[model samples]
Target chain A: MDIWFFLIQVLNGLQYGLLLFLVASGLTLIFGIMGIINLAHGSFYMLGAYLTFWLLQSVDSLLLAIVLALPISAAVGYLIEALLVRVLYRRDHLDQVLLTYGLILIFNEAQRMLWGGDVHGIKVPAALDWSIPLTDTLSYPVYRMAISAVCAALAVGMYLVIQRTRFGMWIRAGASNRDMVAALGINVNLLFGAVFALGAVLAALSGAIAAPISSIGPGMGDTVLIICFVVVVIGGVGSIKGAFLGALLIGLADTFGKVLAPDFASFSVYAVMAAVLLVKPRGLFA
Target chain B: MTTFIAGTGLHTYYGSSHTLHGIDFAVRRGETVALMGRNGMGKSTLLKSLLGIVNPRQGKVTMNGADVTGADTHAIIRRGIAYVPEGRGMFHNLTVREHLVMSARPGNDGRRDWTYERILETFPRLAERLGSLGTHLSGGEQQMLAVGRALMTNPDLLILDEATEGLAPLIRREIWHVIRSIKETGIASIIVDKNVNVLLGLADRHVILVKGEVVYDGSDLTPESEILKRHIGV
Candidate 1:
């Protein structure tokens, strides 16, 4: 491949990896801390995209639509945790799987009922409509770079919240010992609800931003959900740092695999996961 | 003395096994009560039942004249109670500083008596290793961190279960010294330990359990009392 083509591919891989980090980080947090195997996590991403699409009809700016849609996603998450997920905390993984899988079905039906079974497209905002020229003949879209930038900034913000703040400490402590946290007079249920809502907001933000780049349609979340699980498994359950490196590895493998081995494009991601698991049964960071 | 916490006729079970049966326990303001018994004799069960960690099938747990039976653990704890459970309950991911800082809060009566500085001052050994993870600390240091973390809440009531279960002799003495100082500050405490000799001098009252029942409840028993020798083997 030419130098410009390889550069473009690298940027594409990085951008894809950044977006995956936003989604998988939430998955890892909810799984690691709350111990909830939330298969419906990807549905939140779908909701964000749909909400953004719906909001854009009434609002002129895509940025404004996304800003408004995030909180709505968080409320939905908090309500799900309060009304449904709370019951599954003491239950077994089989029960959690059944409930969350049932949730995926419910979410899919809700999406179909509200948005219908048609694919939709969103226009990149006017401010980011142009492209940066990589060569005299080839150029890269500015919106993709903006998405990468936004996701990177959010990643930093997440690190600060989880590592620097007192709330973050409680989360880490609660993950280790729930009974001790409660005995210390901290409201564990409220903390869990907040963490779930935050996870929803991050997943939704990824979807809302990616909607302009990818075609918004039914079952989009299913593919992303499967890929996210692979990321989590490869990185180690509940480790944010693991999710980050794992997402990048998968993103690059998937991006480059298409060019290197077009026939085994889909198999390449799983191949990497299998190889990683072979060396570290518990995962890279576990 | 007014009652800080009282559990009446507590019957707690684990699966088909009955753990605590018809146990009535109480701790008054500024009083230290040592809960004593052999392993699996329901000493921990009584503490758990009173704190709402386990639901008593038949009991009433009251704090300061308010019935708090079947309440959430955090809700019950927020009523001026702090617990240092068995095994120290350390978070391997959190530093000593994070563990203390995260749990720091004013008491239910809005008294910040045990500030972060006060905790560090009490456990200078902890101050020296503020950045170490809770699990990374020595057994003694972890026990001190557990006690310090509990004190950081500025609770009116403190419960310690096996606070020095596995520790060096010097560390155990240090812990007992801190416990003595904590008692001097007028906070009510419920302690469960194997050290009957130390507890005999420290606790204001002693409640001995035998097979899920309170065999003895009084303060006048001497260290060589038949009750302590018979039930605790100490």
Candidate 2:
């Protein structure tokens, strides 16, 4: 066991954990706050990557691509929520699953049709192209560290919004009792739309930031979506803090498992989830 | 003396089972009305129907001269109606303060009387538990929080279903006292409870339901009245 290799893997785990937090946080918000089991959430992440890809090519600026992509993703989320997800409020989980599954199929095919079947890579911003020497032989990418910083800032922003603003109160109240919140004269549908849009933006941002690190391709969202479900379940469905913690745990487990036992790496996160569920069935924070 | 809100010819159903049949009820401005009935007689259903929590298959509900029948719950509530539902409907995860703050709004009539300080003063027990979670409070405390939460909305009409159910004697009296104080503010109220003697003193008029039908509606009856015993008593 090389100590330097292990330390590098830990840094990699932190980077991966932060990225997972961005995606999983939105998943928790959409599921917990709006009571929608949206399987199409990952589609937003994929769309974000593609949108950033297109924008970066056209605008030739990473900052502009990010700025434009947020609102674009949010607008798409608003339309989808109003037109389709709104009808599913009174519906059972099975109906939601069927509809969202159908959406996943549509999104997957659409990506394939538009972008072709080949995997694509995005260049890291010129400003963050440097690396920091971790050991005598190993160096860590600055862009990965930047992902952690941005995710931390977003986490702080989310906490402030949820804890301080009137909008946040409505969300907290809605999460507890949708009917009661509506009866109190807060337009829950509007709140739902806004929260869904925020979720879309967050998911999109996750993809945007991660584009430089990972390959962008058709069906890229499927694996992330499954991992996020595991995160939400282990962290407690509605808790942002829980999602953050769960993501880190899975990130470390996945990173270390690969080096310790390569064959078990793929299933390690699931194993953690299973153990967490056995003790706290509702999730850690639920 | 004006009718603030009224529901007429209301027929509501839960899936295939009809819950309320042709129920007509009204609450006037500054008046206190008691809704009385046995279990499953549709007392709660009528309240829910008024707020659009459960839409009636037939009939109309008019509020402030507007036909609000089948309107969305939030829309109805925004029109100056607040409800304290049965089981208290307290959010298990929310703190007592959050419950109050979330629902706080100025009254539609331009009355800004029910502020946080006023609500806390009215229900001091709630003030002490401001930081406590809704699930942590006792039954009486939960009831107080629910009422305080409704008050914070500063609504024109406050409807409380099962107002004092599952309360101790002292707590029940305290609740009744608060209801009377609320009545003094000239806001209409519809209270549902089984404590006939206590309700008779506070409510200006009584509306009784028997198996989803109105058996009585008048102000002249008392706890000992024949009409009350005949319909409500076993």
Candidate 3:
């Protein structure tokens, strides 16, 4: 491909990487800390997309829609954690898989019933619709850049919350040694509930924000869910820092490989994942 | 004496195999006790039972005379019982500083005595490794870190299950020195170890278990040496 095409694809890769990091960060944290594999995580992302679309249609104000959708998605995430994930806390992973897989189906059927399985595209409220010129003929969308910027900001926020704050300390301690943390007097069940909810909200936010750029569909979350698992495995099972680096690597590789080598594109991401796994079966940073 | 903590008729099991059998034990406000036994003597099992890590089938555990039997580990910790479990159980990802921060007692109290300065003074080696991860430390240093982490809680009763299980001779000496100092502070501890000499070294009382039953209990170590050889085959 030409230079402009390559540059745009690189930009697209970064944007996609950031979004994946956001979703995978939650997945990794919940799985790492709670030791529960939630297959329904992707549904949060799809719900976010659907919520963004609904807000856009109903609210009419693009900025207002974006602002309102975040909290709504967060609440929905809280509900999912409260209602479903809580029950699977001690059950085997296979049970969690079955229940959450069942949830994915339920969510898809619900979305189909409520919104209809139509591609309801989101309009980039004229304000963010413009593009920055990378070349004479090729341009990168400003909105996508905004997604990257916002995701970076959130990553920083998450780092601060996990590394510096009291809650963050509790979480890391609990994740590492549940018995020790409890013996130190932390109400672990309550903590896990909050963490699961927060993870859900973030996952939904990724889905919502990416709605305009990525098409809205029933199976969107399933594809992202698989990628999130790969991302977490590649980054290290439960490390947020690992998730960030891993997402960027996967995003860049998947994007570039697709554009430059169509034949190898589909398998390149897994190839990178396998290589990372080979060195550290626990992932690069678990 | 402060009725700090006690367990009565504690019994437990692991994967259908019974381990602890109705063992009664207690720690007062400020007393250091040692639990000595050979391999598979249920010392660790008793500690786990007290901490709620191992569920007691038929017993009552109380803190300050308040029933806390079957209470979760978090609640037990909040009630002021810190345990340095077997193997140090440190979060290898966290640095020494991070471990201290994470180990701080959340709702413990107004007593601000065991500050960072004092802990660093007690274990200067850990002070140097404060920036290092848990896995980066030597066995002795990790043991010290575990003690430091437990001390940060300023616990009413600190239970050390095999605190010096595997350490170099010098580090072992340092750990004993640390334990002596901790005892001097008037905080009670239940130390489990195979070293009869160490148990006799700092403990005010001795309890040895054989196949989950307390075969010996008292301030006397008269037959403990003989008991250790026969039971532990030391």
Docking class for model 1 is high
- Pairs of residues at least 3 apart in sequence or in different chains that clash in candidate 1: none
Residue-wise C-alpha lDDT for candidate 3, range B76-149, written one tens digit per residue: 87777778888888886688988887766532565756767788898999889889998789888888888888
Rate residue A158 of model 3 by lDDT: 98
Chain A alone, TM-score per model:
0.98, 0.96, 0.94
Please give, for residues B1-234, the per-residue lDDT of candidate 1 as tens digits. Answer: 998889998999998899888888889999999999999999888888998889999989999999999999999998898899999899989999999999988887888999889899999999999999999999999999999999988888899999989899999999999999999999999999999899989999999999999999999878778877888886
What's the DockQ for every one of the candidates?
Answer: 0.89, 0.70, 0.55
TM-score for model 2? 0.95
How far in Å is the alpha carbon of A278 misplaced in model 1? 2.9
TM-scores of the candidates are 0.97, 0.95, 0.88
RMSD of each: 1.4, 2.0, 3.2
Q: Among these predicted structures, which one has the highest TM-score?
A: 1
Model 1, total clashes: 0
* Structure candidate 2, residue pairs in collision: none
DockQ of 1: 0.89
What does the lDDT come to for candidate 1?
A: 0.93
Query: How much is B179 displaced in model 1, in angstroms?
Result: 0.5
Instruction: Show the lowest summed lDDT stretch of 10 residues, model 3 chain A.
Output: A73-82
For model 3 the local lDDT of residue A128 reads 90
Residue pairs that clash (backbone atoms under 3 angstroms), model 3: A182-B74
For candidate 2, the per-residue lDDT at A38 reads 89
